[model samples]
Target: MYGIVQGVGFRPFVYNAAKKYGITGWVNNSGGAVTIDLTGDICNVKKFVIQVVKNPPFPAVVNKVRCVSLQYLHYDDFNIKRSSKESDTVKFIPPDMGTCENCLKDIMDKRGKRYRYAFANCTKCGPRYSVIKELPYDRRRTTMNSFEMCSSCKDEYTTPRDRRFHAETNCCQKCGPSLVIINNKGEIQKCEDVIDETIELIKNGKIVAVKGIGGFHLVCSGRNKVVIGELKNRKKRPSKPLAVMMKDINTVREFCEVNEKEEEILKSSKRPIVILRKKENIDLPENIAQGQKKLGIMLPYTPIHYLLLEQLDVLIMTSGNISGCPIEYKNSSALKNLKNVADYFLMHDREIYVPIDDSVVKVFNGEECIIRRGRGYAPSAEHMEVQDNIVALGAQEKSSISISKNSYVYTSQYLGNLQDFNCYRNYQYVIKHLTGILDVNPKIWVYDMHPLYVSSAYKKEGIKIRVQHHHAHMVSCMAEHNISEKVIGVIYDGTGFGLDGNIWGGEFFIGTRADFNRVGHFEYVDIQGGDAAIREPWRCAVSYLYFCGYDGKFIKNIDKNILDAAIQALNSSLNCYKSSSLGRFFDCIAVLIGLKNFITYDAEAAIALENIIDENVKETYKYKIRNENNVFLIEIKDILQGVLNDINCKLNEGTISAKFHNTISKLTCDLVLKLSKIYSISKVVLSGGVFENEHLLKAVYYELKNNGLEVFFNSKTPINDGGISFGQIAVAEAVTKKQSRE
Candidate 1:
């Protein structure tokens, strides 16, 4: 059955297959599913099932299909049946697909009718989610209804022998969207051609807002500093790095290092904007990525992008939407909201099926790193070992979901931060869409332990399970690698739900997918005003330094009295929340060393610390260890206290940051090494958001390997909370399966 199967040209596929097998049938979409009834000889019916099972179609991930045979019902030749209003609810939908090879080859074919067509597509490709407005996907329900089909195109669409027959998305220059060129006064301007006019305007330094896959893109020539600066000025995006589009991988290599992972990400079907380290010698302007070390780059995910840059140089293709909102895709809205921001609008009449924002990616340890999951990367299922079909609703902040059915776990694309109401509505929208696309009717559910998490409120039906925060993080890494074997999981992040009813961030749990023990851990320090310390690092420093030799009453003599007061208030608390969080430790140390007193972004202090460290300096830290209460402990406080004495030194910040990084690595290595002889855990997984720091990840990975241990790293998804939903789903599945087995 086809729910989202309507707009994606499902009828054409059924018709062609029937014709090839010499069978007669009528296929149509009803309610949310596409149904087909066949009346033919026994051989044809059997061939239908055989072929459908073997090879269905490109990009059509057939979740399942049921076949039934009966006595022949009298029927004539095969025909496309009109859609009905009712059907079973087992049908699945499909996400918006990129351009197909057939259309791509046709567009590139110089002699073909639709040569170099920017809006060219067939039944196999083009918009599905953005343009769709109702069930039983039809021309009337889509934006395509506005365009009357041209005579030539209509003939091919109706002809039974043609590949374009019944292809609803079938279009050409005669009946497709166009680029209208005009000057500042709205005067119609004349030019040689679309490419030439756009190129000339780009060379002359005009900001062109081009419509693409799920939304509009604000384009400007990267070479012109004035134009780029104007784009930033008008877009209200001065500090945020703008994603740049190059012609191909060759040009991309000139600006950034393209290893196998980076190259794979650049060429991936999703075509996400990949964050890469900028080459030191690149002559690009500084306005590209303000206050950031990496530049966001992407290859063309759409045909229009390739044609637009065919003549023009590198183009700054930022999302064509306003800040603090979803990307703009509707024609009327774009005209109203973006009219002031863009000088000229390169528009089209074809409708965008969805407002899917650009997918963002990065490379880590030679694998594709999905940061913002969208477009080509989403709605695809990941088949993993699980107990039951469980939907793990993710946390409130940086939300996404992991739904498991049968043996597969499908993680939804990046849903925006869930703090805003619009983002919340959008999260629900994505949930409905993903459920429709993958056909996941969860039999059970899982949620974050945090009661206030946005996704924790679902209680409509089924068995609900609340999973701890750090446990979910650990299991996510386990499920991604399908690790049934036992290992020591080091989950070090800012905050997580502790088993002992405390906030745990930095933890070492020794176990497999289902079993675990908090074998060894660091001393818990006060959080000092809860989340306030996360924003103001000085509060954390004040709390940490006060306990370790720095005067707790120094606030009377200090200029920043608020930091001292926070420490004072928290010092005498009856219930001081303590954590062994490695992430919190990093923040506290950053404040201690004068790198930062407050943070504007998450991980900014740690990222900047890694950015300045000189990798060539081969330095080792003295790690202190103790076996207390039959548990091994690495004394990180010793190094923290020692650093306070040398704060007056004139050495570079690189040396200081490197020393801390090395110290942390050494302590982790020492603890693991001591545990190896005592315990049989030879496998270790280095996970959490902190793994996003490549510098820190490198040191930990090498140190663990030197201890003769196998490590599982976050190469696919972010080790952060972004990937926690997957872990939650895995834990739920494992628990359910265990119960059934027991």
Candidate 2:
């Protein structure tokens, strides 16, 4: 058995199961794989194997189990032997798990040995990826090695009957790491009751930076408008929604409409921030999520978080970094960087080796779509049955790295955009960190085709393969489904370097990973001030208006100076590039329909547009498709004209947004059907970040399915740039094979 078996109580589970079936030998970790040697009755041994496979540890992912007829040494009973680190394949390190229910009860129970202990955890739950230094996942390989376990705690660990038997992270108040409260003046407050003092400060609406499992979170009372406003102001985040940490499902239901699926995801051990629709006229402060209709809510994942939430109803728990920078994990860094933002600090002694942010997820079409894969969801390998010794550097935005081993591509956590110097450094660090931990030395390096990309510039000592951006997006969807056959891929996202040397976003391609042909795409429009257009949606709106043959006089209510400059740029074609980006199209529509013209973050305008979608409005605007030498041009000028007519008719933004979305969806089906007739391809693959919009995906998915076409979108891997690395890996292998054949 392999894959996340270590550090997740799999050994104990095997021991318990073996004992139940009267199979005797030994079970131990050999690098990444769990080795079991047993000799007993044939039926009992078979039952033991079945039980092990059927009911492994909660967090363990048993990828494959192999049974062999071994010359077993007869033993009286089963025993967990010392782990041996002797294997070519490195073991998978489990992500930090949320505190389990039993441990929660332990901390709450007055008579319990770990009562009120902030670091109380067992084998089933606690920090793993964050604190881990090396493999075999023993106590010494973790930060817990610094803390000497007390006799009582040691007894719980060594006792086979105990739930925490061989639990590497088990600790009590007397032996484990302790917390300290620091005042606003950078002076340590001599307080015995740190939790109580921290709770009191937050109750009074004072913001506190609390050290958590992966990093520090700036927490304040969510109900208090002043505190929430202060947090937003200090963080330099105005309209972006702040995630809230609730006590339990009951508190979450009070503020947000909790469906059954969302409730389960919130309570799951991963404990990702589940984006839930807010209850109409909820009793919470409006400033908590501001203009957004949905609230990002998460349950306590750590013992300290649980302890804090036990007293508080709701807290505005957000990453403790000054917006745009990576999360603050080091105590010294948190104390120094967050001094101005947080009034007080609740810090712990336990060191976090890796800085992992909280993961964010949204329920889409009854499936959990990961927006930000971090914390409890990361450092988890996405397996692929491919050749080893390859590394794929992900896209410039939402960066992550993928290392391929025998049939497994262990992708790194959500490394922020490589655009920032600090985030670039984070990307570099994670590449080195993950490669070191996974013991991977790549012989082949894969990178994006864009020359200016920081990831492409990395000096890797290997054969390099540069893959086209949208092809990688399409291939990523293919790789997730393990598809080898060619399919019609409709890739829509912000931007990607096209093979024809233009910025391609809305793309239609038909092929396998080896090669792809651009069958059709949206007609190119001039992008005035390349990066500048991305920062401000108004520029895109003006560009689209100009493309629709609208003069400067048509740009009423918009800034005259900006409009004039954009028009000048478009007329002269100065510092302007052609792009067929669907993302830019959305941005243009978002601004045209009276959404935010300037964005504080990436995809802000698009998100606002998606949020205001009126699902009941099924009417789609007319669109034109013309084939130019087999490359179909999807003209959106007519769609924009329809939108203008709707706006002139005083239609609300929601209705316009609905019409715009439906038009795009219809256009997708129309283009696919046209291509299907020509290429005889029926498999339609939807990929890229634009598909992260559930409304658009659902519309396209159901429409294609109803039309007797098989539709496949990304489920295992991300549809965004986060999954680009995996696509890079797939393309690399396919290209290599093709080259070898040639």
Candidate 3:
């Protein structure tokens, strides 16, 4: 059996099953798979195999199981054997799981050995990918190897019937890792109880860096605006929303609305931060989300988190890092990097071999969409039909790496953008670690087509293939849906290098996994000052107005000198690049409606626009679709004029935003219907960061489906750049196969 069989109590479950079925067999971990040898009656063996395959232990994902008839040596009884050092085949290393109910009960039991233990874990729940250093996932190959189990723990580990049997991370307070509270000056603070002291510090409005299963979290009281502002100033994070760790589901329900699907994702074993809509007139500070309408909320997923949150209702739990840096995982690094940002440190002795961020998710149209794939939902592997060993270095932003081995593509967790030096180094480290753990030697290297991307420029000794960015976006959704035939693809985002050497974001294509033809796209507009147009929305606004035969005199709250410089750049074509990005289009509208002048984060303007939309508005702005040389161009000149007219009439921002969104949705449906009619295709795939907006996604999804066509979006992988690496792998395989066929 392969796929997530290691370190998940699969062997113990198998051993127990064999004894129950009156069979003699041995089970052991080999590489990443569980191997079993059985000698018994044919019917009994078949029944045992069926039971094991059908009913795996909690959190165990059995992807494939194979059985072969062989001459079995006579064994007296079933037993668990030692692991083998076979490294030929590939198997999955499970992602780190949230604390299970059984383990939580053990921690709460006063008479138990692990009562009130901060590091309490069982086979069903604990760190897996974070602490693992090698294959065959044994204690000796993990960070837990340093701790020596006490006699009590050793007895439980040796007992076959015990839940902790062969649990590699099993230990008590006496033998496992312990926590300590320290001042920012690196001196250990003498305290009676560390958990109590940490709780007291947080309640007293002190910022504490709490080490977690994957990395460190900078935690504070979320309800206190003054403390949150102080944290923002200290961490140099100005406007980005900070995630809150609520005590329980009831606390989450107190502040935000939760539906059935959202609640299921929140209380799941893989606890991720769910973006929820805040209730009207809630007591949360405006600075928490900084003008956004949603809040990122999560429940305590670890024993230490449960202990710390026991005395507090809510705490601001953000990544322990400065702005534009990867999360700090090592104790010494945390001390050195975060000493100035944190007031106190909740230190632990357990090592984190890999640092993973918290996963972010949201529910749209009753489906859970992953925004960021990390701690509880990362190191995700999927089976694919491919011939060669492949490694796909993903795009620059939302960086991740993927490796293919044994016909399975394993994608790494979300690594931050590679623009920062520290993030770049961490990206390299993750690549080496993932490839080493899976033992994959890359015969093919795949990357994006953008020459300026750090991932595209990476040096490796293999056959290199550069894939178009938006095509990868389209195929990513297609591959997730197992679609191999041709379909209409709607790909939109902030930036992608076009085949004509321009930036492409708003795009439509008719394509298969191997190839695609550009069918329609938004018309190109000049991005003044190059990359600065992305940061300053007013610049994009001026560019759009200039192209629409309007002057910048009507715009307000922008520096006159900078505005003139932007116009000059546009006029002379200096540092101006033509972009067809719908994201920039949203930014332009955001500035025109006086939503924001500048942005501090990615998609800030677009998010603000989405937040103010009135779902009841049925009106849409005028748009023109022109067929220019067999390719449809979605012209926004009329739409720009409509937005200007609304601004002149002093219309409400909500109405304007809603009208613009509706126009896009209607135009999308119209364009897809036209293409479907022309090409005789019935399936439409939508993929990109723009689809992260729930309103647009729902509108486009249902509109296409209502028109007698099949609609698909990414569910298994991210719809953003985070899923680009997996898509690159898909494209590489298809291209290679096509080449061989030719």
Give the number of the best model, judged by lDDT: 3
On a 0 to 100 scale, what is the lDDT of residue 169 in model 2?
Answer: 86
Q: After superposition on all CA atoms, what RMSD does each candidate show versus the true structure?
A: 4.9, 1.7, 1.1
lDDT of 3 by residue, 626-695 (tens): 9999999999899999999998998999999999999999999999999999999999999999999889
Q: In every candidate, how many clashes are there? A: 8, 1, 0
Give each model's whole-structure lDDT: 0.72, 0.88, 0.91
Instruction: Evaluate model 1: give its TM-score.
Output: 0.82
What are the runs in model 3 whose C-alpha is more than 4 Å off? Answer: none
Comparing candidate 1 with candidate 3, which one achieves the higher lDDT? 3
Best by TM-score: 3
Instruction: Judge candidate 1 at residue 200 and give its lDDT.
Output: 75
lDDT of 2: 0.88
Candidate 1 lDDT over residue span 311-335, tens digit each: 8658899988666556767667776
Which pairs of residues collide in candidate 1?
Answer: 2-34, 129-353, 130-353, 130-354, 131-353, 373-414, 383-408, 506-581
